[model samples]
Target: MALLREREWYAISLRPQGQHRRLRDAVTRAGGHLLALSPLRIVALDGADARSRLRDALAASRCVFTSPNAVTCAARLQALTTSRTIAVGAGTAAALRRHGIANAIAPDRMDSEGVLDLAELQAVAGQRIGLVSGEGGRGLIERSLRERGADVVRANVYRRDVAKFSPTALKRFDALPAATALFVTSAEALDAALGQLDGERRAKLLAFPTVVASERLREACVRSGFGRIVVAASAQPTDLVQAATTLV
Candidate 1:
């Protein structure tokens, strides 16, 4: 009890609804109160000829899905092909499994660098690759693959819009401590979450300790005026939970 009282037990995740369960469970098991502070919503985009475009692009030696949302969007946009596939993390790999992608593998480290480190991705001087992701992301992955002599094509399968919570919702959440640390996964979501707050509220949010998924996100937090930021080694929910447990 004394050890539990030494640190505030609240941990917040700013991801979408379908992305919450594992993190929530991890936080609860870690003796912390998990909160969902979603500031963005993912909407898959499909054009009239979306299916045809996806079919053409996915006709490759390998295909990479950047997120669970990427897999979700791709599943809706077109029929997944028989090409070898990869997911960026455990959450994403699970989503793929639910979607019947049984052979999918997520790297031990969940990030672009991890994806790039896969033995399968190396020594592909003339192979074709397709990346299914949201509008903007994985630029490094694409660039690195190109440099490695793979022909890579990309398709934006979804769009993420700002979450719309009523004033009542924000007011209710205010009852939770402003010093509640946030688990921020993306720079865009961080900006959106902070944008919803007033100057004072934003200040409070920044002053609260934050656990981010990457150094890039940490830099984004710094630019957005976040004061106390901890960069987790990976984007896994378990990593975030373990990080929260060790915090002061």
Candidate 2:
């Protein structure tokens, strides 16, 4: 009788806390295990100043959301309204639709450069653009819009903090299978996740086949010493999981 090949796969998730359910479920359905290594925690900023900035963003001629977290946090502060709405990616656009902002559109490339490539943004000589996002990211979008002569107002609705991992989490990571793949989407999350690891563990992780969300992230993985890298179709949970499963 011929021996059967084993088909178990493992993927390390570096998404933010409370954002791993869909990816976990997808990995489970693919007959694989998902190890949570959430390196970032999202904190919603709903203070008076945050609310006022959100109001200004909503009142602008064009409003742009940088992430799903931005959409959710902005929705919590107040209603999302604008003449035209743009999301950095399809995921953010979906989040906006879930919050009843159905007219939001996203670029095909799903990045700062992609957002800037949109034709709608090309002719903004004297337009007010509101950027709804987390704290201290997506500066490229703001800068480019301003260079295009658009008055860009940034409304920071959330902040990303480095998450603390427990001892058990480190132990679990140490015990991960040799054939496991690393899934990295956000460059910030990647930096935070690797920063929390000791040298040995970090080197071991860099040796794994990494699946990144974009070419930019692939370059980041290369610079971070990841030996092998693969770019996923998009940052969507299903896409990332699908790409990871192919590695092992």
Candidate 3:
């Protein structure tokens, strides 16, 4: 697909529900239109058992937040304390700072492997570690902590649900212009969005130039038959938008 510089640049966001505002605003600022496609909904876990788990995790020696959503959901349940906090990336670290946890640290790489390479986690034998995240993701962090002889407490503060798109929304996606770039951050969200489309629509979307958040996601896009892929510097909205706009 060729990008006509004279035409308006467009970007398709596959972020979760209520999470497209920042990206949308960023795209607008760059003089590009954003096709917001929410394929997942973030549901906070507020049951009694979940609360108890969160409390225990918060009281641990070291606490790690998997994502910004995890930080938000955890903050809603209880006051954030100044425990030895680690965030998966700069965005999650910013979320921690917003909740009054200023000393939170994040790795430059902004991924699970990066978190494991931290000096604080290197000597974690017999230490109690708390993992705050959504359900069924970031298993590598939890499993690696245990292998390092740390007592890991997993607090599942939220869950991702597959969101339903309206018929109108589906039609809009099907009619997107060829100059549109697909911005994908989460492989799961991308899969959920692709699952909603018919074979023809799916193939058409796969042919569009895609901007992925990481090399891992680039590989996922490759396996999904995406012809052109660009890896963003980080999962941040600015980086994703910058990478997407570069194609034009």
- For 11-51, candidate 2 gives per-residue lDDT tens digits of 88998988989888877777778888889999999799999
Ranking by TM-score: 2, 3, 1
User: How high a TM-score does candidate 2 get?
Assistant: 0.95
Number of backbone collisions per candidate: 0, 0, 0
Preferred candidate (lDDT higher): 2 or 3 = 3
Whole-model lDDT, model 2: 0.88
- Compared with the true structure, all predictions reach lDDT values of 0.79, 0.88, 0.89
For candidate 3, give the lDDT of residue 3.
31
RMSD of each: 2.7, 3.1, 2.8
Local distance difference test, candidate 3? 0.89
Candidate 3, pairs of clashing residues: none
Question: What stretches of model 3 exceed 4 Å from their correct place?
Answer: 1-6
Q: Which stretches of model 1 miss by more than 4 angstroms? A: 1-8
Q: How many backbone clashes does candidate 1 have?
A: 0
Ranking of predictions according to lDDT: 3, 2, 1
Q: What ranges in model 2 sit over 4 Å off?
A: 1-6
